[model samples]
Target: MPLHPKIAEILAILPAPPDGPLDPVAMRAGEESQVPPLEQRLPLHAVEDTVAGEVPVRIYTPVEAEAYGLLIYLHGGAFFLGSLDTHDHIARNLAKETGLRVVSVGYRRAPEAAFPAGLEDCYAVVHWAADNGEWLGWNGETLAVVGDSSGGTFVAALTAMAQDAGFDRITHQVLFYPSLDLDFDVDRYASLRENAKGYGLETGILKAFNAFYLDSGADPADPLVSPIKRADLTGLPPALIVTAEYDPMRDEGELYGKRLAEAGVDATVSRYEGAGHGFVQHFSWLPEYHRVYEETAAFLDRRAE
Candidate 1:
């Protein structure tokens, strides 16, 4: 499908990244400045800023629905820029949509923290949430995770990492247009080449993001870094891998879903046509964007018997 009209309109005027190595501070400030005022934040039952597992997080309680379980949301800025305030609206809306106590993580980014630092924070927060369920309130029957773009990679990796460490508490995972494979040269997917340029998230930006995140000589092919490289996906949590038709990262996410099913893990892949990367957060007004969250809520809404 061709790019959606609204998305195309937005892309037509999209600004290019600075012509040099991105200034993470300036870029972060630029994005954070766009967040609405705290008083202007979308209405929720309650919202609190606190530290979870030594990582900054914002907890959002929905206005009306009883939360099914706790969900840790990892926002995406290609592993470098994005904070609680940058994604506050998305997290609040997700809480409202799914009735899950949503925690948006503000993990340390790179090329400062580099590779495993952010992932470690996310994994720790997941455990922290489980252990602190009592004080956080609403200990529903499940612990789920939802992350988009680069953050989606963390959500997928958490499942594998947790499985190896024998921490099996997570019940569901939702990956929204995740960059699952960072090993760029080997077995490159056509989407990276076909949808390489025009889309808002171009291949160039992806490479730069990967470079910034992995400046510490981390092997991009490591299973934790690229979930697609995981040889064993069996016994991982049930997954909902959402892809955008025109996204450079689209095929890798779908491939991960296919591999998960092959390994006997339940996984569903749904590609939103005419959409590019970050459609879920950047273009929420589109009916198609809403479907991803609907599917996400349905996937994570299980009540324990």
Candidate 2:
């Protein structure tokens, strides 16, 4: 499908990234500025910014329905950008749409807290959220994890780690255009070239993210870095892997979903036709965001039955 006409119109007026090497600070600031005001983001019954085991988390409860489950949402910024504030609206709206208590984590970022540090922070929040079931008002059985872009990468890594640790607490995983494979090679995935430039993820940005997020001695192929490289996808929770039609990460997200299904784990891959990456965060401006939210809510709602 072609670009959604509405998105295309918005893109027309948007400024392109500076034509040079990446500046993490400016990049983060630019992205964060696009988020709507907190009040305009979501209307939740309650929203609390609290700490979970040393990790900061913003919790959201639905306004209209009794909570059905709990979700730990990791914001995406190529692992270097984004924070709880940048994703507040999405988390709150997701909680409202799915009747799931959403905890938006403020994990450490790269250049300052590279690799395992950020991942560990997010992983810790998951455990803390589960261990404090009474406080969160959700049982461990209905817990799930969600993320977009690099945050989705953390979701994939944390889910795999949780399974390996014999903690079957997480029931589902939701990935939106997730960067599952960190060892990115343009030649390896055709989508890299086809959708590399204009669909939100600028070309060469992945490499820039990798350089900042990974330590010099770290292995890119480490399963923690690239969940798609994991040997066994079995015994993992069911997943709803969403990909944007023209996003560079589309193929890899779908590939991860394929691997999960082949490993006998129930996984569903849904492509957003004519949509770009990060569309979920721009719900007020993008109509297709509602479609993804509806699908997400239905998937979680079915698990309750």
Candidate 3:
């Protein structure tokens, strides 16, 4: 199928590629320019809570009293640039759609804090949400984990760690166009590299970000570093994995979903044709994006029930 018309138009308007290597600063500025301004509405309740000694998190609760499940979301920025502000719209939309309280973590980014630091921050927030669910008027046992792109990488890692560490509070996991493996040998990457507009993610830029985020001491194959490397995926919560038809990460995400199914985990994987990476964040601009949001909400609602 051809690319969506709106996406094609947006791609045409993108600025010229940078002459130098892509750094965190450049990535942040590029993202801001491409995306629309985030909505300024305040979270129903924004509270700073400490996790794992001193890791701080900002939790956003929905206004409705209808007791929805808790969704602990980690924002995507290739482990470097995203913040509560950058991903605030997503948190708000998720909260409103599922009637779930969305707790968005301000996880430490790299090159300052590499590999495990960002993952640890996300883990801490999940643990904190589970421990203090009732205090925040949420059902702890009904907690879900969600993320996109690099954040999806963390989500995959955290889910695996949670299972290994006996953090059984999570009931579901959602990944949108997730980068599941550090190994970039997949055919999808090759396909993307050949077509300029096939994938929004630049291969070289992605490689650069991965290099900066991984630590010298970290093994690329560690299940905590790459969830797809895990030997056992059993007993993990049911998952809803969304991918883009033309995304470089598409194959890996689909492969992970397959592994989950093989391990007896209930998983639903969907790839929207004519879409590329980061479509979930553009729900307000694209009808296809809105369709994804509705599908995701329906999936969550059914699972929660």
Best by lDDT: 1
- Candidate 3 lDDT score relative to the true structure: 0.76
Please identify model 3 stretches exceeding 4 Å from their true place.
29-53, 186-198, 215-218
Better of 1 and 3 by lDDT: 1
What's model 1's overall lDDT? 0.84
Task: Write down the TM-score for model 3.
Answer: 0.89
Whose TM-score is greatest here?
Answer: 1
Candidate 2 regions with alpha-carbon error over 4 angstroms: 64-68, 215-218
In model 2, the clashing pairs are none
**1-305 per-residue lDDT for model 1 (tens digits):** 79999999989997766787778888888887787787886798889899986899888888645344789999988888777888787898789888888988999888788678999999999999988878777564778989988889899988889999999899899898998899775248988888888878887677777778878555787988888998878899989899998988888899899999999887889889999998987897688687766777888875422
Q: Cα RMSD (Å) per model?
A: 1.9, 2.0, 2.9
Ranking of models by TM-score: 1, 2, 3
The residue-by-residue lDDT of candidate 2 on 80-165, one tens digit each, is 88888887777877887788889999999987785689899999999998888888887545788999888899999999999899
lDDT of 2 at 106: 96
Candidate number with the higher TM-score (2 or 3) = 2
Please report, in order, the local distance difference test score of every candidate based on alpha carbons.
Answer: 0.84, 0.83, 0.76
Q: What is the lDDT of residue 4 in candidate 3?
A: 86
Expressed as tens digits, the lDDT of each residue in 211-279 for candidate 3 is 767643345678776678888898888899998877777777898999999999989999888888788
Sorted on lDDT, best first, the list reads: 1, 2, 3
Instruction: State the local distance difference test value for candidate 2.
Output: 0.83
